[model samples]
Target: MSFFTEIQTERLRLRKLKHTDWEAISYLRSDPDVNKFVKRASADTQEKALAFIEKIRQATETNSSLYWVITKQGQNQMIGSICLWNFSQDRKKAEVGYDLHPLTQGKGIMNEALKAIINFGFNTLNLNRIEAYTQNNNTASINLLKRNNFKLVIGKQDADNLENAVYELKQP
Candidate 1:
């Protein structure tokens, strides 16, 4: 798969991250609320954001993973990111992660993006299972996963840090 591919939905486009996206990504990552659940080497600097974009580029270049910048069709504004990570060598499983800008919350944009990526994971990538983990406090994420047909197989106490819930969706 190429590093950059445009995925068109009814109202959104999931495209590869670009160097020109730095300004928008920087703003989104800088938001404490937006960065609350994200994990990164450093969340405090532009360099960290650049490094992340580079890492995503490298991952796509190697065909090891896929990440997309969620944008609206006919507009260049970036509202979020959706990614498939931790791909198995046998191509049987992978994990999905996503985040939307605080301003864009409550708009159903993420739900649409999640559906598109899940289809890509199962149909395009031919994965058998896709999973996601979110902090217990992040109800929005958990609900999004649930709405997308991800079952809550594990509970709070089963989490590594007692602060997350793991959800999984198996291909049928």
Candidate 2:
């Protein structure tokens, strides 16, 4: 829990961000299709992507968050990213965020990565809750959460992004 841990599944690997992953990060963060539902600063350039990676590195060092770059089982190129961040003061709760390259969408890749992340959060991190915020119109994300047993957080609002629909999966 103190260091960035790599997660592996049958066909995917989720590892810490690397300097060389800048290209994929840049595309993932800035692509219109990917960002259509996410509202965040763009890291469209390699320089910006590197800066973001550094920030994530610092967060992991401080135990503030864990970010992972998603790749195919035997591939070195990044096709997506996922992280657990925005932890509550008691550390029992944390927000989950993810993105997949458009080409990789609808392939159950994110779902596989998420299952592993959820296990890590509840078991390794011993967290009580994992939250996700998505644009209300993002049916794909909503469905993904549902498939993972995450429930809609009734009456909860995303102060940072009003357009986001809040969902949570309590530790079972």
Candidate 3:
């Protein structure tokens, strides 16, 4: 029932998350630099990280989400992660989420990964829209979204997280 698939771009690979990706996931979730503007629970310990991996695995098996680990082409170690989840009840919309190792930031790595995901969402999955919610103060993420042509959703807000501003990219 999973929609898991491997995606290859010019310089990167977006593939299924493996159990061995725990260390990278642990750091990506808990690192101060990476989570500075993030507002979710962190996997600060190994056990918590593993649990998260299992959660993601089960979610994928249920077709609840599509998650990918980002790495340079031919590499197995994950330097970042991205996902399309939180599908709207009608299945026309889904939220996009991502994070990268600080060392990998500013390299346009995420920009490429997101482009691929957007294509998958719109063309492959037949989605009508892809949404992103970032802290209004998270300039890097906001800029990334805008660069991908995601427009700020006027007057719409995340009720549970007032600090978040929603952005959306509709099918072309």
The 0-to-1 C-alpha lDDT of every candidate, in the order given, reads 0.82, 0.93, 0.93
Minimum summed lDDT over a 10-residue window in model 3 is located at 1-10
lDDT of 1 by residue, 1-172 (tens): 4634568999999998988787777777777788687554443567777877898899998878888999998888888998898888897898898888888999999999999988888888888999887877898998899898998865424334456677899998
How much is 123 displaced in model 1, in angstroms?
A: 0.8
Ranking by TM-score: 3, 2, 1
lDDT of candidate 2 over 1-172, digit per residue (tens):
4756888899999988889999898999899999999999899888999999999889999989899889999999999999999999999999999999999999999999999999999998899999999999999999999999999998999998899989999998
**Deviation from native of the Cα of residue 70 in model 1, angstroms:** 0.3
- Name the lDDT value of residue 129 in candidate 3: 95
Query: Tens digits of per-residue lDDT for model 3 on 121-149?
Result: 99888899999999999999999999999
Clash totals for all models, in order? Answer: 0, 0, 0
What TM-score, computed on C-alpha atoms, does each candidate reach? 0.90, 0.97, 0.98
lDDT-based ranking: 3, 2, 1
Count backbone overlaps in model 2: 0
As a whole number from 0 to 100, the lDDT of residue 21 in candidate 2 is: 91
Off by over 4 Å in 1: 1-4, 155-161
